[model samples]
Target: MTSTGMTGTDTTSTGTTGEPGDRTGAHTDTDVAVVGAGPTGLLLAGDLASAGLRVTLVERRPHATGNLTRAFGVHARTLELLDARGLADELVGTGTTLTRLRLFSSLVLDLSRLRSRFPYLLVTPQYEVERLLERRARAAGVEFRRGTALRALRQDAEGVTAELAPPGDGGAVTRLRARYLVGADGVRSTVRDQLGLPFPGRSVVRSLVLADVRLADPPEDVLAANGTGDAFAFVAPFGDGWYRVMGWDRRHQVPDDVPADLDEIRGIARRALGSDFGMRDARWISRFHSDERQVPAYRVGRVLLAGDAAHVHSPAGGQGMNTGLQDAANLSWKLAAVLRGDTDDPQALLDSYHAERHPVGTAVVRGSGTIIRLAMARTPLRRAARTAVARLVTTVRPVSAAVTGMLSGIAVSYPAGRGAHRLAGRRVPDLLLAEGRLYELLRAGSFVLVAPRDTHPAAPEIAAAPGGVVRAVWANPSRRGALLVRPDGYIAWARG
Candidate 1:
């Protein structure tokens, strides 16, 4: 087992016997191996490959499925991230722009108050997002091993060794060696299970019914109800008289226990919509209960976890996918740095990922749990308290904005490390740049400095940088380059 020149052919099994030909062929080797082909994994693979690192992506699914509309909303911060990679424009072109998010109960709180150029949400299914990212990853020369599952893993000082099995019917196992491994698998991740990490959280008592229905008479607005008498629903218009209806089953029924018949779905719809709405077509339906769980740590040894593997909470504010994408963005650059041998201190730099992301995950779980609990309060006294709080929040602009900002992921900030400026953790606003937008600057490479207008001071000495592309840009404050921006679309350091 030499450290160098390990490709797709070398094979040595510890316990399980692999397919005869598996060891005969060259084994695929890369700087990083990513488990799961979901949004986070695909985005991470694309980023790592684009950064000139060999990346191998493994997915247990035999092929891509575009049927499930799991996550339907993309927040402003996530939009900014995609925009940075030149994918936002394409996404906005395909998806509908949600200008307003109206909370319905005894009162309404407009989500448009969140500060940003993209003050609204984007309505795009999770499948579309994965498709775009997968395309980008393939274009970047990433090797995607579809229908592959990790059978076993062993890490040493040099790199990680993963034994992968093909999907369906026990097939030959292939050995994959990489400098690092990323677990982006869903809640029940084999990677997390192998790592012996504890996922601590409680499941909600009541289960909810979700459906994508084409209504004969659709609601005029996007409505999110906290407590609507007997049911709670979050309705978002997806164009063409289609609405994504999500509501809690007052009877607290599970998917298996209750029939998924159209009549049942329509009953739930009518309860929330206040009308016997005729559902012409029902695309998909499922029952799910809210669960709040987060991994104690995002990293262990050479393996790391992202997305649902790292944190799982109620989808109250649609923060799941957005939070996972942010996880990919934040970890990609640092991993690239380590792989490129820019620094010898791997543990210190890697620890920051957990430190920065854990708090945000905690906040999301706590906040979303609070919102869901208040909305589902059964007693009259609790309902009154919830309504009073909502009204009071609406009356105070700052308080309301702050609450909305947290849900939108605009309030996430990182701690300033070595060589980091005050703006390191803060998100950089979209500004006009010579290249095009401030996000365009990030597409080139990581650690960018937007030089102040009319000021050409000596460039900061950036170490282990990627060629000359990592230099500062002289931005025109009047047009663009108003301030320096980070890869995560946050202000690293800015000047007026």
Candidate 2:
């Protein structure tokens, strides 16, 4: 099969299909069928195919039209996930890292103080991430069907059958069968609609303008953001020659279909940010509205939803894409295990996807909503309160840590099982191993068992507890006994 790269390159796609004993009478064309070739689906499909499962990714958009600049900031935890897949360093080189995030005119958050290898948010276009993930997915043999629209979907006890509309008008429809299907489509998700799921939320802000332009005179700060009583503006570098500028004007609240002239954007930016920095020569511009919406359930029987398909929020914290990427990381391994028959109770394992991620999605929606609301505070008292809160978050140590931890995604953790170790379900920091680092050990895309160095000689056997778990030893040989790190770099289980 032919696979088209995001850079408009051509490649071949081939993958091995898994045949579980449970599929007695039902035969699937692929192990997993993924809709939407965005970052979430690409990562999930790549991980599945790397685990020796056949994955077919269907995308409604054409390959050549992949340049989307909606999301620009990649948070630290997302960089760590890419590190596990050996793509973080390369991605980092492609963009600028902003250690200081300026909000409102005076308040600043120091991202460099975050406790992680990637201490700053990387400013790059969303396509850069898609480019890397698409390469990996194609190299891992994930079949890609571009310009194919999902028409209908049905799931039986055995598998999911997806009816797809091929490229071009009035073309013949095709059907693909798979044991599981994932909808990583986007905020306007067809799969979610097909599942009859209601996206419950309200539009927080409207008449928001976005543009990528060549700034004749750039701002001194890597990132500049501020919100006046009547307008708000945010500016950041794309690392290329162009920069991303977004703003909103309360006085000019027009419909989204109205054309956003460069002059209007510059006027709003100058009013909110003090200066437009000679913004000119726009390459792309659009007016949009942001809504805080999420699906009630991420998983429904054999079909699951991810990324924007599962949740969407105001782009206040720059967590939209990062949250989706993490969602894929959290769900991909469990799906692979169930499809491969590594787990006995597949339903429980699949159900955990919704159980663990729904709360996080809720938190993201609320947190981002809070930020955007504060930024758009119009009343004098509310603006004062916003300033006070910002000051507390920047000055108070505990408050700063909490806010930064949640925003940077380093402090996010899932619920541990009953009587489990304290570290269980928490993200594991990259520790120095005898040979390399924790993330390096995860490049194989499987569970990793890390034992203290110089432990009992049977440590390797303990690591090989069942399935395909990789073994590693701590470089310093601490008092900690053993830690089973999930493929996504969370503590599955730990014994001290």
Q: Every model's Cα RMSD, please?
A: 7.2, 7.1
Clash number by candidate, in order: 16, 0
Cα lDDT tens digits for candidate 2, 107-174: 78888898889999999999999999999999999999998999999877678899999756777898
104-135 per-residue lDDT for model 1 (tens digits): 56545566776676777888778879889999
- Measured on C-alpha atoms, candidate 2 has an lDDT of 0.83
Q: Which stretches of candidate 2 lie over 4 Å from their true place?
A: 1-21, 167-169, 454-466
Give me the overall lDDT of model 1.
0.72
After aligning candidate 1 to the native by TM-score, how far in Å is the CA of 267 from where it should be?
1.9
Looking at model 2, report the run of 10 residues with the lowest lDDT sum.
1-10
TM-score of each: 0.87, 0.93
Best by lDDT: 2
RMSD of 1: 7.2
